[model samples]
Target: MTFSAVSPDEIAQPKPELRIGFLLMNHFTLMQVAGLVESLRFAADESFSSRQIFCQWEWMTCDNQPVTASCGLPVSPTAPLDFNQHWDYLVLAGGLLEETRNPPAWLLDAVREIHARNIPIITLCSGAFIVGNAGLLDGKRCAIHFTTRDEFRQRFPKAIPVIDKTYIKDGGIISCPGGTAIDLAADLIRKHCGEMRAEKGLQYLLVDNGKSRSTKKATGEAATLLYDNPAVRKVIDFMRHHLDSPLPLSEVAEFSALTVRQLNQLFIKNTGYTAAVYWRRMRLEHARKLMSDTDSSIHAIATTCGFSDASHLVDWFRKQYGETPGSFRKRRRDVEKLVKP
Candidate 1:
């Protein structure tokens, strides 16, 4: 179909003075940091006239020391992390949350100080752990990596955790699951700047490349019975649709037109887990999402995820994660504090 195009004059320009700082720690993910920098650089280049994108930027490392990425590559920062200068936005980009003991008091103070002033902050990947540590996410809605979602939930039951979304902007605090760094930056550019500049920034980054984009199904409902196997897929689809209230193994087997033993064998063969185990895992996944993304009570979460009670959920979670759900959520919340919000 043909469509009308808007003239160049109608496109909005980005304001150039927005300062974006990358808070680098040891063993940071290089790709995520690079993605953020490149997106901003592209935005800056495209909006040079307005100077609204990249005029003010800095890579602030802990103690101004040279940092190493998880991949063993070294990254030298452009500036020392002195919380003095006024920054418009800050990003906590690192993967060393598990080892960040005795964080410099200044860094914590700076985050708290800056966030108290209402500045925006973004955390990528495990950096959410640092942000959570900062205590800024105590009652805010945020996103964490799916791999780390369970840990995050057990740690911070108060912080609302979202599922599946790459990132979330709850007021001034922006949290991304990481890896999808470009999406986070693009959202920032579009929100604080403009959609056109964000588009151009994407183009500058050559982000419309293969494997970087996902093929989205037409609608949520379109995925109701997506697979071709009428019986097995039907049971799978039902489980997917009822993640908040998962069916028992017997019910699943009946729905799939198989006996319990037959269904169990087939599921184990296909997914490397028994039917009950797979269903529990699926329910736990939904529970993890709710735990990380919502303020729901543990009791409610347990029931929603098809557990008999909170204790049952906790027992399974601990067996799987080596920690209680509450502790895990708190740990992630503690990490989120590292980002300046």
Candidate 2:
């Protein structure tokens, strides 16, 4: 029998790791949708080539109808809703309290049918109320914004609203606050693809994300973010920018207009870590990225990441990652070599 040979490059076909369907609600938040879609888009491609190889995302509606957003931008659906079509997750991104109230009866039925099919659903911002209205969020913990908590409670008494967390996944329903969809997308990419691919998107988006959700040790409860707290975000940004020159917590606290104790409390409450601890972790994350992407020596990388010296970085690196920087770099490079043609 005669057969034609297939090159390795050809064998590396485009098999997407995730198939996500976005179901937009009327008067949805355009910023949230755009951030989420762009995050997945970047993760789907290689080096921002914009190909949907790693991840596949589509905008779908009940009858291929166009949905208008709160920002006055209308998006035409790419396909009609098909329950039989397999999807990794279905995202529902709706707008404020007024927009979410009195949602179309069909939309409610659609979520009920989606729940019946055992498909996971992701709710963004006020989208929580939509699922709550359909009785899907009953007896389940969900994340919602503070503004709508009172009404959501009165509307759906059984559904417990959690406002502090950026996102929470109780069983099949994952709910996130407004504008945190990008973080959710990055996390999904990390789950199906890998950390590096997720980081690629975050890095390009200029997301500081020193303690990315995917890398953190899972607590029984949901993880947190700095989106709602400007003070903490400012401090985190300060730490990221001055990675090569470590600063005192008191100095950072002064810049944030909060006392040392107050700053530490904010950091602990938001990030699950004290300011000093979070700063150290952030430095370690930077060191790891440098080890993976650069050819700098240990001393140079240590100094660049604000470590006292090579020994100091190695000590913390081994403590956190359970491997020396040299060992980690070697393994990563070995994998890359194997994947090359």
- What are the lDDT scores of the predictions, listed in order? 0.64, 0.74
TM-score winner: 2
Among all windows of ten consecutive residues in candidate 2, which has the lowest summed lDDT? 1-10
Least accurate 10 contiguous residues by lDDT in model 1: 216-225
| lDDT (10s digit) by residue, model 2, range 181-278 | 67777777766666888888888888877655433333221233323356766787788788888777788889889899999887765454678888
State the number of backbone clashes in model 2: 0
Q: For candidate 2, give the lDDT of residue 201.
A: 84
* Model 1 residue 188 CA deviation in Å: 1.9
Question: What is the per-residue lDDT of model 1 for residues 265-306, given as tens digits with 9 covering 90 to 100?
Answer: 766443345768767877876676576667899899998888
Cα lDDT of model 2 overall?
A: 0.74
The global Cα lDDT (0 to 1) of model 1 is: 0.64
Clash count, one per candidate = 42, 0
